[model samples]
Target: MEPIYKISTKKIRLLLAAVVIPCLIISITRLYYCDKVEYVRPLALEGEMQLRNDRFGDGHYAARRAGGKRHAGVDILADLDTPVIAIRGGRARALIDEDGFGNYIIITHWDETKSLYGHLSRVLLPPLGFVRQGDVIGEVGKTGNANYKSMKAHMHFEIRRKGKTIDPTFIMEAENIKK
Candidate 1:
């Protein structure tokens, strides 16, 4: 007698198709979710927060005045000489040692959001270049027009979307804020 054929060709085909189809579907779903959800962390680690003020002490706060005056940026005050990291995976769109921002590093993120780290003591090499998420962008210092008296040596962080300034607090979801 001929050796009996154990499994049918149709069953084998079905088994292979079932396993392959689910994997393909899962991969597509994962990609979609990953693209949609962009996570960013605070530029600075846990530290002391200082009072917010305009560089010139003009009574108007940096964030509030920026909105109406078309300035668009937020200022977070952390310790001086603190390390500033990239919030998300993105390219260094621009690095400017301007009058007000000091040694500033601007990162253009995946979601078209730009995160600004200012008042840096020293910026890393390849100044205007690409960097991975969590890369050290610069060291926090009272550069630019930072009011060291009131703000101290702190990282002035800002987030801009569509070339307009929005509240950085809205985007930051880090639960590391100290009391």
Candidate 2:
């Protein structure tokens, strides 16, 4: 007999299909979830009162003399001591007590946008250097120098874009939640 030669075309095609199929699936799934922003509104008052703020009406900014004071946050209405939760998956960047915002927690999301939960009555620290989505950052209260009491005790939620405050309402819409 001469030299025996065999090539399995079926085997080659099967190998290619197996590799290609999984690659396609992974690519599609990645595009679906990559850097997509997710959020949950601050706790409602017994699920009755909706979130609001007198400082800036929904989709509007408070005017300032320095320039147009674009409202950079969405206010979430909660009881005087309701817990404020993270709206997206990320780590805690900073939690600061200040004059205007009072005690606040800054949570960073995958998209690089930072969610600021402010005017909190109290904040629970995560080992002083750790936090995650759905973590309770603080309790709502009127602590800031701002007139939080007259406005109602709630979480002042702000989403910063490139370090600038834009209407957080736009972000809520992008995340597809009704204001």
Candidate 3:
């Protein structure tokens, strides 16, 4: 007779669980913390502009406003009248002239993401207009909070998902801006 060996079903399940549990934890951790690589630069003005601030997070810049309010976007330092282009294809949702944002344009992209172009010298599109990626939307200006004579001219750019502000840098790396 040949010798025979058998392992219990419970033992096999326990062995598999031990291996699978750690893998599940690792995958979840990486998905939550890893940098996303699917985004494109907002514009081709890398050389002409500089990053003034970044999104709110560890080792990132804090965006704050008057009265100790938290800021919800990134600021790109650029010259006045510098053309502002659409980061991605989207519909022009709002073109408003207000005291806070001055002249601003809100675009709702196909992915349900929204981009806000604030402190604009001029808005090129009317409300509800559709724009293609890289199309000119407006010019940089020192409107709204940036209107003070002492402030430098720049564009207040922001990216949002479902009405919540997210770091624009994540969508378009500041260092990789096109020349």
lDDT of 2 by residue, 1-179 (tens): 76597658998897788677632222322221122235554443343335564654442334342254555665666778887767665556545566667888787555667778788888875664345545577788876744434677667777776897666655444544322
Assess each prediction's global lDDT (C-alpha) against the native. 0.61, 0.60, 0.66
Task: Residues 109-139, candidate 1: write the lDDT tens digits.
Answer: 6566788877788887354476766667777
For every candidate, C-alpha RMSD to the true structure in Å: 9.2, 8.6, 11.9
Backbone clash numbers for all candidates listed: 3, 0, 1
Candidate 3 per-residue lDDT, tens place, 127-170, comes to 44867666688988878866777677777778788878877765
Candidate 1 weakest lDDT stretch, 10 residues: 28-37
TM-score of model 1 vs. true structure: 0.61
Error in Å for residue 146 of model 1:
1.2
Q: Estimate candidate 2's alpha-carbon lDDT, on a 0 to 1 scale.
A: 0.60
Candidate whose lDDT is highest: 3
Q: Which residue segments of model 3 deviate by more than 4 Å? A: 1-40, 53-61, 126-128, 174-179
Q: TM-score for every candidate vs. truth?
A: 0.61, 0.61, 0.65
lDDT rank order: 3, 1, 2
Ten contiguous residues with the weakest lDDT in model 2: 25-34
Pairing residues by index, what is the TM-score of model 2? Answer: 0.61
User: Model 3, residue 19: displacement in angstroms?
Assistant: 43
